[model samples]
Target chain A: MKLNIALLPGDGIGPDVVVQAVKSLQAVADAFGHTFHFEEALVGAIAIDKTGDPLPEETLAVCKKSDAVLFGAIGDPKYDNDPKAKVRPEQGLLKLRKSLGLFTNIRPIKAYPTLIEKSPLKKDIISGTDFTIYRELTGGIYFGEKKISEDGTIASDLCEYSEAEIERIAHLAFKATRSRKNKLTLVDKANVLETSRLWRRVVTTIGKSYPDVELDFLFVDNAAMQIILNPSQFDVILTENMFGDIISDEGSVIGGSIGLLASASVGSDIAMFEPIHGSYPQAKGKDIANPVASILSAAMLLEHFNLKEEAETIQYAVEKSLEKGVVTPDLDKNSTYGTNKVGDFIADFILHAE
Target chain B: MKLNIALLPGDGIGPDVVVQAVKSLQAVADAFGHTFHFEEALVGAIAIDKTGDPLPEETLAVCKKSDAVLFGAIGDPKYDNDPKAKVRPEQGLLKLRKSLGLFTNIRPIKAYPTLIEKSPLKKDIISGTDFTIYRELTGGIYFGEKKISEDGTIASDLCEYSEAEIERIAHLAFKATRSRKNKLTLVDKANVLETSRLWRRVVTTIGKSYPDVELDFLFVDNAAMQIILNPSQFDVILTENMFGDIISDEGSVIGGSIGLLASASVGSDIAMFEPIHGSYPQAKGKDIANPVASILSAAMLLEHFNLKEEAETIQYAVEKSLEKGVVTPDLDKNSTYGTNKVGDFIADFILHAE
Candidate 1:
């Protein structure tokens, strides 16, 4: 099989992590007897510095031509601190998602046994926790019509949802649920908001088609508490854009290191994989940042194309690395490996996997 | 001093816990040499059972006539399970908030040392966590306009925040911040939502008035993650209505048990205090429900009245109860004390404090 992948090493530690993910991808390709081609593109703060645009026209063209995009990270301290700045690095990623119609973000939170003790949560409470959050990316109040009065006293945002919007994501969640634990929990404030009520109605009707998947509802407030109290109780969580943003980020803490979580944003035709962590400007040139999240993102990119064995190989290598304590300082302060060494170890493990 | 308080024990363990709060309030009144007058009103499922309305007109009248309202939990399995039911207990609380114009909901989360081991989080991580969430109530999408398409296919809720609304809550949070840690964190999704941008503009301007209080900002998504990762970092959290609802509930876990969390809703003139826990139908009439949250609500009520010494006395007595192992089973699995016994112990302690 031949695959075309786009690499967007945005800014800061983005370049370091992307290099590691590319090496791991190459290793996966070698072990699986597959051919993979990569194209590099400029985005985010680096793009702004080079071309005066966070996402250049050529960068978007390269992404459109690729079968998949592996993103590293986006952000810069310069842009982050200046609230008055009209243009920033994060805009590039948001625009790319909108341009490519990447409307659904999938984040899987799992408590690895080897790292469970590292979690802020007690081992007994977090051991069995594993769930994925399917967050609607492009709709809801976040993108709704916003208005401010002439005097700047009143501001309003309209949170609108159509049957089509809810159905598109509901199908993904319900189908995924059928394959996993056969349970789908929709998190919304249905008791209050019209959009949430619509979510319930649409998801409930859609669930009838997938009889094997059990469907349930939880208010967002209760869902937030439950994520901390009993994360294992959830299998697949479906929520609107804003609720999804909050809940999925909250889920990121379940595994202890935000640096270790990878996310995938996909739509009907396009998919993008990236580490959820931000680009640490302080660690940009140090080569000490963790590369596991980047490597796992490569795995998610493979799984997006039905390459389950290849994906599992990458996952296994990561687990083995953690078990052997071959990690960066973020996970183990005493470990001697830097970002590149950790990447090298994982690639070597992946290539040797049976 | 003379005080007129309204007591609304909605359903299930609501009555049980409210009884304990009343007892504690009486103890505070005696210690502070104050005359307290109590009036009772019906709301929630119980009110629906007798009056066919959740928040009856007379009930609102009673709350209006009071200096403050002390509320217990509200909800029953009968209403929760039946989604198609037109009348529900939560509607009563929502209506009561709207009727009384209670626009600010304040929830304080403290990691009590005696109960640190009971938390799902590692003790070291949560031991020093203490913060309050000032949630803008009676606005945002919850009370926004709702519309459903004639074809039952589309729905939308408008999330509007006036500068007046933002300023009202921001002032409260900023003022409180000065008296506390002199640090205020405004949580919003400014990059995405128009309402959030308005919030930032209004709050930033308001921050100028309180030069002693340091102000910072956090996106709702990052705020949720930070709550779990480093809750101790927050001093006072101010947020819009819906974000507040989700974040505040998420904050409840920092302290361990939802049964020990209490909240206060205050507007320009009226304030209502209630436990953050729901009415547990299973524990009704069993005398096993935890009453600490309700007792703490009474403590918050005293604090709201500028009776700082009286509030601290109640807080001190409650701490003494936890130290003496006088809590119900929720805090201690080996404990034999019932809800009433625990309430009596705290009240007894409060009345005898030097």
Candidate 2:
């Protein structure tokens, strides 16, 4: 098989981590006897600095012509604190999603046995926790009409969802449930928000077609507590844009380290994979940033293309790395390994390990 | 001091737990030599059942004519699943908050030493966690305009905020910072939502008046993760209505059980107190529901009226009950004590213990 991957190593530790992911992918290609080509493009803060636009026209063109996109972190502290800034780094990623017609984001939260004790949650609580979150990405308040009064004393954002938007994501979520434990939990504030009511109604109608999957609903507030109280109760969680942004980040903690979580955003024509962790600007050049999340994202990209064996090899290598204690300071303060050495171990394991 | 209290023991375990709170309050009144008059009113599902309105004019009148209100839980399972139902038990609470001008909701999340082991979070992560969340209650999306299209194909909810609403809550939260750790964290989605940017702008300007306090900002998604990663790093967290609803509930788990939390909603002229936990219909008549949250809410009511000594007594009595292992089934499954027995123990301690 041949694959052309568009690599967007955005900013800060993104460049560092994406280097490690590419190493693992190169190793996978070598071991699996596949032809792989990688094209690089500038995005986010780096792009903003170079071209004054976070998403450069050339970058979008490259992504559109590629088989898939492998994204790194975006956002810089400078743009984050300036509430009045017109052009921001996050706008780049948001535009990419919209331009590519990416409608759904899937994040799998699984507790690794070796890393369970590192979690803030107790071992017994997160031991067997395994769940996935399907988030609607293209629509909602993020893309809604935003208004500010002429006097600048008032501001508003409209959160709207059409049936088509909800139906597309709801179908993906229900289809995901069948492939998992066959339990789907829709987390929304249906009791209060009109948009949430539409979600509940649409998802409920969709659930009838997948009668084998058990469906349930939880108020977002209650769902927040339930995530901390008992995460094992969930199989697949479906929610709107804003709710999903909050819940999936909350669910990211169950893995003990945000450094180990990966996510995939899918559209009809293209799919993009990225780490759930952020830029971590403080650790940019320190060589202490964890690269497992980016490497796992590469594995997810492989699985997206139906390269199951290649994806599993990368996952198995990552598990072995954790078991052998070859981790960055985030996971183990006493370990001397940095980002490069840890990635080296995984790539080497992929080439030689049975 | 003489005080007139409105009691709205709403539905399900609301009446059951509110009775325990009354027992503790009566004990406080007797021990502290205060004159207290209690008035009962109908609200929530029970009110809808009797008067065909969730918040009847009579209930609002009772609350307005009283010094303060002690609210129990609301909502029934029957109203939860029916998204099409025009009348919901929660409408009672929303109407009551709007009518009474309850704008700011204060919830303090603290990890008690005796109950720390019961928390799902590891001890080191949640051990000394103590923080308060100031949530804007009467504004934002909950009170904003909600609309569904005639064809029911599209739905929207507008989240709007004005300078005055942000200023009032900002002052309250900043004043709170002076009383404890001089740190305040404003949680919002400023990078995306226009309303959040207004919140950041208003709060940042108001923060200059609070020179002694240190103020910072966090995006809601990162805030959710930080709440689990390191809860002790916060002092006072201020956020908009919906973010607060989700965050404060997530923050509730730090104390080991939601059953041990209490909250206060304050306005210009009126203040209401209630347990943060919901009405658990399953435990409604079982005599197995925990009563500590309701009792703590009564203590907050006393504090609202400048009855500091009386409030301390109730808090100390509840602490003593926990320290002595006299708790409901939720906290200690092996304990033989029931809800009524636990309330009796707290009341007995308030009356007799030093």
Candidate 3:
């Protein structure tokens, strides 16, 4: 098989980590007797400097032509703290999601047994916790009608959700549930918000088609509490964009480190994979940012192509890397290994794993 | 001082808990040599059953005449599971907030040293965690325009915020901060929501007036993660309505049990105090419900009325009760104390402490 992959190593440590993901993907391709064509493109702050646009037209074109896109982190502290700036780095990623019609974001939260002690939660509470969150990315408050008064005293953001938007994501999440533990929990504030009520109605309506999957509804407030109280009870969680943003990050705490989580944003014809962590401007060029999230994202990309065995090999390599302490300082503070070294260790383990 | 307090013991274990809170309040009044007048009103499911309106006009009238209102829990599981019902017990609480203009809700999350082990989080992670959350209670998506399409295919809710609304609560929170740690963290989705941007602008503008108080901003997403990662870093959290509903519950995790939390909703002329937990319908008449939250709420009511020493006495007694293992099952599972018994212990301690 042949795959055309677009690589967007946006800014900061993005380029350094993408290099590792690319090397690991190359190893996966070699072992599986496949060919992967990688096309590199610019995005985020660096693109803004060179092309005057954070997401250049050329980048979008390459992403459109590729089978899948592998993304490194975006943003810089220079752009982050300056609220008065006209152009921002995050706008690029938001635009990419809208242009690509990438509506569904899947973030899997799983606690690793070996790293349980790293969690703020007791081991008994966080262990055996496995759940996937499906967030609607292209709609809701993120893309709503926003207005600031001429006097600048008042501001408003409209949170609107069309039934079609809810239905599409509900269907995708329902299907995802069929393959998992067959339990789906819809997290919303239906008791308070009209949009939430609509979501409940649509998802509950769509639920009839998937009789095998058990369904439950939790108010977003209670859901936030339950996520910490009894994370093991949830299998798949479906929610709107804003709630998703908060809960997915909260979900990262279950793993004890946001640096280890990766996500896949899937649309009809195009999909993109990236680490759940942000661009750490401090770690730029330091070779200390964790690359396992990006490397694991590459594993997800393989699984996207129905190469389950290849994906499992990458996952096993990640586990082995953690066990052997071949990780960045974030994962093993006492270790002397750097980002590239950890990536090299995982890639080599992937190549040699039985 | 002469005080007129309205007591609304809504449903389930509401009456039992309110009874304890009232007893504690009586002890405070006697200790402080204050005259007190008490009026009891009906609300929630019980109100609906008798007057056909969950929040009857008479109940509202009594609350208006009172200096402060004390509320027990509301709602029933019967109404919770039935979505088809038009009127709910919650509507009564919502109506009360709107009518009374209780725009700011203050919930203090404090970890008790004796009860730290009950938390799912490690003791080291949750110990010494003390923060107060000020949630704009009357506006945002909760009161926004909700529309359902004729075909029931689309649902939308408009999240609108005016500068005045944000200003009032920001001031309240800022004032509270001055009395405590002199730090305030405004939680919003400024990166995405127009309403959040409005919030950020207004709060920042207000922040400039208080040079003594250090102010910071956190995206709602990052705030959720930080609440667990480093809860001690937060002193006072000010957020809009919906975000508050979610984050406060998440903050409750640090305190080990939601049953131990209390809240105060204040306006210029009127204030309301209540335990943050809802009616535990299952524990109704079982004598197992925790009354500490309610009793503590009564203590807060005393403080609101300028009875500082009286409030301190009640707080000290509640702490001593916890120290002596004279708590409800929620706080001490091995203890066989009943709801009335816990109230008696607190009341006795308050009298003896004086």
Leading candidate by lDDT: 2
CA shift at B140, candidate 2, in angstroms? 1.2
Alpha-carbon RMSD, candidate 1: 1.8
lDDT of each: 0.91, 0.93, 0.89
Local error of candidate 2 at residue A34 (angstroms): 1.8
Worst 10 residues of 3 chain A by lDDT: A152-161
lDDT of 3 by residue, B1-354 (tens): 999999999999998899999989888778778888899999998888889888999999999999999999899877778879778898899899888999999998988887888888888888889899999988888888888788877677878899999999999899888768999999998877889988988899999999889999999989998988888889999999999999998998767877778899987679999999889899998999999899989988987777878988988888888888888888877999999998999898888787
After superposing candidate 2, which stretches have Cα over 4 Å from the reference? A45-53, A75-91, A285-287, B48-53, B75-88, B282-286
**Structure candidate 3, residue pairs in collision:** none
Model 2 native-contact share = 0.92
Off by over 4 Å in 3: A81-86, B77-87
Alpha-carbon runs more than 4 Å astray in model 1? A82-86, B78-86
Compose the digit string of candidate 2's lDDT tens values, residues B1-354. 899999999988989899999999999889888888999999998998899999999999999999999999999988877878789999899889989999999998999889999898999999889899999998999878999999999999999999999999999999988867999999999989999999999999999999999999999999999999999999999999999999999999866878889999998888999998889998998999899999999998998888888888999999899999999989989999999999999999999964
User: Across residues B1-354, which tens digit of lDDT does each residue of candidate 1 receive?
Assistant: 799999999999999999999998899888879988999999999998899998999999999999999998788778789969899889999889888889999999999999898888888889789899999988888888999999988899999989899898899999888658999999999887888999999999989899999999999989988888788999999999889989998888768878888899999887999998888899997989999899999999998988988888888988999898998998888999999999999889888885
